[model samples]
Target: MTTAVSLQNVSKSYGEFKAVDSLSLDITSGCVFGLLGPNGAGKTTTIRMIVNITVPDSGSVYIFGEPASAKLRSKIGYLPEERGLYKKMKVREQLLFLAGLKGVDSKDSANRIVTWAERLKIAEWLDKKTEELSKGMQQKIQFIAALLHEPRLLILDEPFSGLDPVNTSLLMEVIRELSKSGVTIILSTHVMEQVEKLCDEICLINKSRKVLAGRLRDVKSNYGIRKLLIAFDGGDSFLKDDSLSVERFPEHYELNISSVEQAQQILRKAINAGAIIRKFELLEPSLHEIFVNKVTGVDG
Candidate 1:
């Protein structure tokens, strides 16, 4: 596979603080790559550099195997975290103007706008002023604006924000379809559940540094299965064991155990305490758990 984007020792700083420190990444073409990090971890700064909005103090950024340049911006579609749209402008007019900036022909851009608006179920809002729409509606419009030019590399920052569950699912489906059509996407968001479902690979940064980067499945496998889930009805004495670390959910209990032997021991204890076990299974660590552990330095 071709490398869609590459960064070599890229670093960016603001006065006394380093926003990104010696970062390096290689995103494959036609893949959904997750750029994940906690707040103020430089995820936004890194993206700004990729789109040529902010230049790195040292190192380099390459897009589609070429050095980053203004001409290459035409191939990239960026939906920034901070939404930018003319509130007073009508939806159709705003989209057309933005598409024109990308050098998309007016006729072609208008047709594409209609296609995306219908596909996103926002066609009815085309004639309405941007300010009259809700935040979710505005988000959909911004999303359409990004797609008007049919960019090869799409970078979406918190694309699911402000969307309800139904709209979120709709957007996720659209993203999957876009990926299937061979569009490379860089998804930057703090929502780990969505990332787990949508991303093929992920790079996690903390404090402006790379902490984890790999194929999603491989990253999880490397962590191994360190947790177990048990559903039961009876005495909860086993959960109080000092040797066991546990999280209590409404339907089940998640226990962190090191070995099969330890899990078996807990099962025996639960049964002995008159607990009727309905479900007991060893589970791989979830992306959410991994994110928490890595960000907090608990995994180290």
Candidate 2:
């Protein structure tokens, strides 16, 4: 139950623009915490403060309850949205350089590099210059560099960007393993599905302010079980119900019901309309829907 990262009333501004306004959030130790928001929502600014890449104008940032410092940064691994590595340097050499900055010794650093490279299936490309690799390949290398020191805390901004599904799955498996081994992770990404899968807790920011923060289950549950998924065959006439807000899929239709009574009415109507019901269930609001609801003021 210890706090891994804390931002207390942190604020950052660029002249006339306030990038982060009194933003405060606590990320628990040994869990994946999703830092979510739409574009220009101050997510990157907040993360920059966490890693001390940019100092906050006011308030404070603490890692493991201590002030953020250069020495402390050795224990923190940060992967920014922009990929940075020596284009002319070999993969091994670049990783070694990054690891050295974190105070990792050559012997241990090389060992971890080998381990991670092999695990990520990038061992074959270690001898290749970074410029020779594909974007997805480069992303894997960045991931390896981030963990080269075996950091206790990992902050990844848009980690899955430009990755093919195969590589994305590979990275996700490693992330899950890291979480299981008690490494605290702060994930900032626009991918809501990934957040739903990986994050235990979340803090949503909007226009440089905190709009939502808490356990994911509790947050979704608070919105109530208003979503319904129904699979049917034959007629599509049942979808004409004006009271229902519907989203169509090839195999099913997702409908918004006001209450349990409404759900029952929907089922009866579908049956009466000659549609054979194959599946019917009540479901919680998705993080994507919740985020859209909070940030855009649209019904989730």
Candidate 3:
């Protein structure tokens, strides 16, 4: 397995506060890797170090086997959480300039820009100033700019921030295609559902430390069968058990159970309580559930 990005005991500090502790992580090539954490958990700092926007105060950051440096950074495309664009500049001119900075030729950049804009359904807006577009439109433009040079490593922070469901699905499909084409992506987002659907591996950090890291399947499997989803009417009375964590919906309920024995017990109890069970099944722990548990220091 080739390594796309590697951090060795990396630490960063700002004034008296430590932004990142002695953290070490490896991202494999051609995979969509999730860098997830709650707000202010060193995710942005770590990404900055990887893209050479900020140097680590201690230890090292390596990209594609080379120490992160200006020369090596051209192979990286970074979309920061904060949106940045020359609001006054035309979208075409802005993208051409940014792509040029990454060593893309003017002719090639123009062609690629047209291709991307068409694919993203923003071709007609290219001649307009970025400030003239809506937030979602500007976001799509920025996303296009990031890939203009076709970098090997893509780092996206909150890539779906302003997108509606349709555009969000479009972007997700594009990201998966990019990964299939061998572009390694570092996705930093608070959206757990997106991480579950897109990422092959993930790392969770909190308070400047890693709380979890592994292949997505292995990480979820390690937690065992602890969740149950069922649809039933009149089962609300049986859900009063204090030991179970229940999330109620109009048509179904999700319950957290300890074991198979506990699940069977709950099923029987619900049935005997004059409830109709439309569906019942054990479920794998969701990424959101795992994230909340880890961050809150809750076991199982």
Candidate 4:
């Protein structure tokens, strides 16, 4: 497997503050890689280095194994968090400008503009001024311009911010299709659920440093506790078993057993309490939960 992006010992500081402190990460080809962190956690700084918009103070950023160069930027599509387009320019003209900046020819650029605009359902808005469009409409156009050249690596910062759920799902489909066609993506967002659904792997950053990085499945599996939720219609005293560390709800108890055999024993204990079990199920730790656990030391 080839790497689409690699950062090694990358560090960026602003006077007394280090925005990105010794950050290193690898994003492979043909998959969505998530950069998960809270605001002010250096995600945007790292991305800036990747795109060469901001040079790293003491590290290297390699795009496709070459030093981050302007020539290689054409192969990279970036949708920045702050949307930037000429407010007075027509959508089509703006996309054309961006395409030309990336060294795309006029005819081919126009063709791709049309194709992407139509696919994004903004074909009719091409001739209109960008300022005339609503925020969501403007976002759709910006997304088209970003991908008009069909770049192999996409760096999207908070791509789902302005879109409604319908449009969010729509763009998610596009991202998935891009990945299926071997376009590597580096996504940055605070939305953990989106990462859970979209990312193949993830690197979690905290206070300008990587706290976790691995395959998504491996991260989740390793971070999980095999806990179960059981709703039994009785007092908490019924579940005072030595094998289970059970917590009680208003009318039921959530049980945690060390093993599957212990779960069976818990079930029998519930029955012996002369209580009816309502909802009994295993619970998996969500990415949001894991993140809070790792970052805040709040794992329970």
Report the Cα lDDT for residue 213, model 4.
94
**Tens-place lDDT digits, model 1, residues 82-196:** 9878999999999999999999999999999999999999999999999999999999999998888899999999999989999999999999999999999999999999999
TM-score of structure candidate 1: 0.92
Better of 1 and 2 by TM-score: 1
Quality of model 3 by C-alpha lDDT: 0.93
- TM-score, every prediction: 0.92, 0.91, 0.91, 0.91
How well is each residue in 134-165 modelled by candidate 3, as lDDT tens digits?
99999999898899989999999999998999
Number of residue pairs clashing in candidate 3, backbone atoms closer than 3 angstroms, sequence gap of 3 or more or interchain: 0
Clashing pairs in 4: none
The candidate 3 region of ten consecutive residues with least summed lDDT is 233-242
Instruction: Show where candidate 2 strays beyond 4 Å.
Output: 231-241, 247-252, 265-276
Model 1 gets an lDDT of: 0.94
The residue ranges of model 4 lying beyond 4 angstroms of the native Cα positions read: 224-226, 239-268
What local distance difference test score does each model get?
Answer: 0.94, 0.91, 0.93, 0.87
Question: Which pairs clash in the backbone of model 2?
Answer: none
TM-score of 3: 0.91
Q: Which residue segments of model 3 deviate by more than 4 Å? A: 231-242, 245-253, 265-277
Clashes of each: 0, 0, 0, 0
